[model samples]
Target chain A: MSTLSERILGAPHGNYVDRKVDRAYVCDGTGMLTLETWKRMGAARLSDASRLHVFFDHIVPANNSTTATLQHELREFACNSSLTLSDIGGGICHQVMSEGIVLPGEVVVGADSHSCTSGAFGAFSTGVGATDMAAIWLTGETWFRVPDSIAIHLSGSLRGGAEAKDLALSYVNRLWMDGGTYCALEFIGEGVKTLQMDERLTLCNMAVETGAKTGMFYADDITVQYLAAKGQTVRPQVPETCTYIRNLELDLGDIVPVVAVPHRVDTIKPVQDLAGLPLDQVFVGTCTNGRYSDLVRFAKIVKGRKVAVRTIIVPASRQVLSEAVRTGILADLVDAGCTIGTPGCGPCLGAHMGVLGEGEVCLSTANRNFRNRMGVGGEIYLSSVATAAASSLTGEITEPEVA
Target chain B: MMQGIGHAVCLGQDIDTDLVIAGRYLRTKDHSQWVAHVFEDLDTSIAPRLKGAVIVAGKNFGCGSSREQAAIALREAGVVAVIAPTFARIFFRNAINIGLPAIECNITCTEGQKIRFNLADGWVEAEGKQYPIRPLSPRMQEILAAGGLVNYWKARS
Candidate 1:
């Protein structure tokens, strides 16, 4: 038997980046669709039995008619397919499926770009176009291109002021815009040595922003230990060796506070550069920097302060929600009059959940602020949670003043 | 890598794969049904009048996902080539990897700037400069000559 990597790279018949390669469909059982936008296709494709997950999540708080329609379709599809993960209302799509569904070494695809989040479980996860996803939904298979690989090694101690959000933004800046195209970004290093599981998840969540197919920080003892506590799957262990085409190195010690300005991710500069720039709003959420530490960081910054007239905080998961509540961070936030939101993706997707209206400028920790991405007549500047939090309080672009 | 002033239009940055062909219309069986709809959101007249069109854009012109459909839809819709101050990391590679002529140069084109791009001749004429962009690496030239990956592989067989 050929090794899995060999099968992945050698079989052009089954590998494609959209140029009609041959048929090579196999199931490792790491995916499913909860919405019927995919149901317009057949159900047997999901009967790959092991490959299907068909979950209904992240479409909640149905803020508008279109989201409501998609959610209704998802309920119908999940019911028709008899899938367990379907209709699991209260979690992010990535969190819901992997809670107990996705297994290791599985090659999975989803329509959502963040589908790569499954790599945390050691699966070969990537996102697909809705049409390709539809075809896979009918035939139970799709193809792929053997992408090049880039290794990002994070080594050193994260000083008191730095966090994963800072690290991710720093990494993106170093690579600039076209640094990691059609490549697999493999994150490795020593500073990663002490980061807990959710923090590591926060790092890999935005890997797609670099134009990489997926970002995978290898699962080590930390991975297994966290899973064991959750009672999730414990797969055999091995060191992840890299066949990276190139390597970029980083030390958390020197990563300065930064923000990606309007229009482009690579146009990043130190947050201090834009001092006194008026800020109309500040947002702290999205799959990227919306974890517990993110909230804790925001709370710490806003403890004795009040949000400038227009600032919002969006927690990404119910898990982060409960933990923030348990630690009393949510109360500190509300006491400061920061408009805290439910555990759904809001400001990030421009789903209108927390959009800033026309002529408004928001400093945010969310990713991808494309035209109208957050709402009409609004401009979004991408930044770390610390920057967003500090800006919310000062009512202008600022840094976390917390010592 | 196109030739002559087929005409140039300026589009703002963050021009995603969806702006080329929206995700919702992807389910259609006939590509013409949807490919023709490419960029309808940006400019309705673009598709019908693109038989000999060229585009010049600011940096990160196609900086989004590795969706080749974006290139395919553009090619099928008659966009000869693109010259950008810079391009998205993935979109740049995807274009070249799939044998589409996408060039990156440190230049800008104003609206209605007369331009002649010769991918075959290996240079461009824009804003009164005939600067050179290295032509397709030999392997890439072959892929583009073959008119896409499937045909290239078919010829190899």
Candidate 2:
């Protein structure tokens, strides 16, 4: 009986002893530039270009001349190397990978911290930097120490307006932001079966905020269905016996809509506890909670209400944006006075579009409320898309009513 | 062999890459420009203090984001080494690949405290106290010795 990490690690390199991985991914943010620079600096040529995935979703549509030039260089590299490129507005790398590239039981690595979002499909996915990516690009292999495992057993189902974002916040609150550092969080229990695929992605996405190497779930029927819908077939694997350094049990029924206060991800409080806090802005997107389903949830809450505060909605991918447009989700949101931005990272990376002003408060669905995340001196409150939508109407922090 | 002795510039836990250097500064791949903005969010004065200093941070230092520029910024800013209980995997690997020495030790130290770090000896000394540090892997040691991953690979080629 091996842990999920061990199985994936072993599968890739024939055994977990070597921990050498084959697949590596990169995004437009720093990765493309770094790779190009490294190549000029005499790094070896890319080994098996097919294994490397590249995307230009961080600052899609080119926020400035520098970003535009960087994207142009990445485009040329992708074309020269014959690598698959998710061009500007195609979507985020994690979302693109989950939709097409990533498969169950594979060891997936990306050059973005949110690469853990692929763990929703049971892959051993984690983030790495440009230097490591450059090395992997040249050699088709990189090292891993085979992190220890932490078991988080969730029971029951979320009620009382609680969502996966709330569950993630509660876990971060319990685990502390850095409690899972160097450890892989293995999420299991009855509640696991109850979550939607997107919900599970949300849970795994924020695992990095807890400092976990990666967060993974058992690949079950839902995972297979998800992959099948994406035109891929996968036979999910479940580890029979696994060792957990620390085991924690959480009841989903016990969770309520919660928000992570500014300066740190773990500083959480119930949404009701912080209700009526004035909000200057509300953002409803990011790789963390920006999917079609997330947009649907946000639209449902903001359908007929005019936002009292400045609200920005960014779909995670071009596919999500198209779907929202087709389903009239975008229309509903737009009619509700929500400003829709391009399908890139938007203000989540603080790169461009909807940056916060000094001393302003923003209710956002994006992960990581660290200081200066949206902007310096701007306070960020992280919550579910539903909460963000509800708060946008009231111009304060408020939890949406459960249907 | 890599060795450095300098005063400690202490930082708290989860000192993320964004805090080290924001994404807004990453558009240009200029190392010098990035170094000037190191720790700009935490303390404007800390950037000047980083020169010839060893950063001593709590657990999970260099968490968040996979930008190698965080490590590059520190190295270019004249930071000799970074000592912390633990580091995010990406940052740890980047630091080593870029020839920046990162030591893992759970010893306590205050800002401005004199400390000595020796990679070959695998130990860090401060306040008349010494703590054993884990040595880097042979592959990593070779890379650092050659001044960076590109140099190591170039030398081998």
Candidate 3:
């Protein structure tokens, strides 16, 4: 029995001695710099320009003079190479790629660690370094030593007020210690069939936190529908039989609103455990939980109420923002005293905008809570959109009550 | 055949890329500037001790973020090698590609303890105790011998 990863690799390499990826993509951060360095070093593209997808997100709109220069260089590279450039505010690389570029059964590699977010569509997506991406830019191929697959069979449905974020956090709590390091986490079973496309994206986006190569779900009817909604019509193949090195099962209904405390993504605790812990800020958007549905959930909890603490809500993409506006979710958020930021990765990396001060605490919907992730000397608590919105109202960590 | 002998500085698990070098410093591509801030957040005092020292860290030594700058900063700080129980895949590859030797070993070494590593033998000697390390693939070994992936690729082309 072959795993889904094996099936996809087999389709692309077809008995070749060395497994080669199907395509490669890069974001503005490392990819552009790597390409610029390559050009300076006298290397020219050796493959079709279409094989590369360039994104300018991480530091959109050029937060500083140095960043502006880097962005300018990226634009120049895109122009000179005749490659597709998803410019600033064009949405995060993973979001844009999932919505348009990445397809099921494809082996896609990107320079950003969260590239595994594309695995939501059943693609074998994983992160690589700039050098690897540069190599792929030249040859359109890079090798992969097939990774062992870990089977996580989730059953039951999530309890109200809990979300894919909680499920993902719980999985990290259980698996991050030693389970998924350098392994592919193939989520399966009844619960997998119930999660929406956005939720699946959230799950896969944080797979890197578990040290997993990629977190994937078998693309079924939901995936087809998601693609169909995007005007793509294709049936994605799923492997009939798969072998796993380890098997784990979880009940989604058992998951509660939880948060990953500061300094580590896996240091998780239920929201009830830390309720009333004061918060300095609350963020409602990022590649992990930034979607139209997430905004809607945030709006529902904060509507007709003023934010008691500093709060920022950023839609993952311009498309999500447009939808939020059309549905009046943006208005509700703005009315509730939350700052509405543009569609880009804002303070998730503490690069710019909404960075926290020393001795401050923030509950964010974004993935990853490593030390200094949001700002130096500030503690970051990772939670679901519902928890973040609820916490913003009380100025402290709170669990959303399901009525 | 390559070898290095240095004092070890030990750290805990999940010493992520951000801790190695913050994202704020990523604005500039200057390798030297990044080295100055290595472990700035983890411990302001660690960077000074990094030169010519071996870092002994717990599992997932370089985790979070795909910026090769983390590996570059460590190398620029004169870290001869990073010995960890495990490493995040991307960081490991970035280190090898950039000519930084990352050895995987589960042995414990005291801080400031003189340690020796033999790349050819794939072993680490600390406090007179020897621990076997997993050797890199032939391709990676060749790349390191050539001083990094850019040079390795340049040599081939």
| Residue-level lDDT tens digits of model 2 in A174-284 | 998788887789999988999988999999999988888799998999999988998998886766766788998999999999999987889999999999999999998
Candidate 3: give the TM-score of chain A: 0.96
TM-score of each: 0.73, 0.96, 0.96
For residues A142-172, could you state the per-residue lDDT of candidate 3 as single tens digits? 7676678888899999987889999999998
CA lDDT, every prediction?
A: 0.62, 0.85, 0.85
Candidate number of the best DockQ: 2
The TM-scores, chain A only, for the candidates as listed are 0.85, 0.96, 0.96
Q: Roughly what TM-score does model 2 have, to 2 decimal places?
A: 0.96
The runs of at least 3 residues in candidate 1 whose Cα sits more than 4 Å from the true structure, single-residue gaps closed, are: A1-45, A54-59, A84-89, A97-104, A235-237, A240-242, B1-14, B18-62, B65-157
Question: Of models 1 and 2, which has the larger TM-score?
Answer: 2
Worst 10 residues of 2 chain A by lDDT: A11-20
* Model 1 vs. true fold: TM: 0.73
Write candidate 3's Cα lDDT for B1-157 as tens digits: 2578888998988889999999888877677999888889999988989988999999988888899889889888989898998999999988988888889889887999998998888899999999999887777788788877777777666
Candidate 1: residue B40 Cα off by (Å)? 8.0
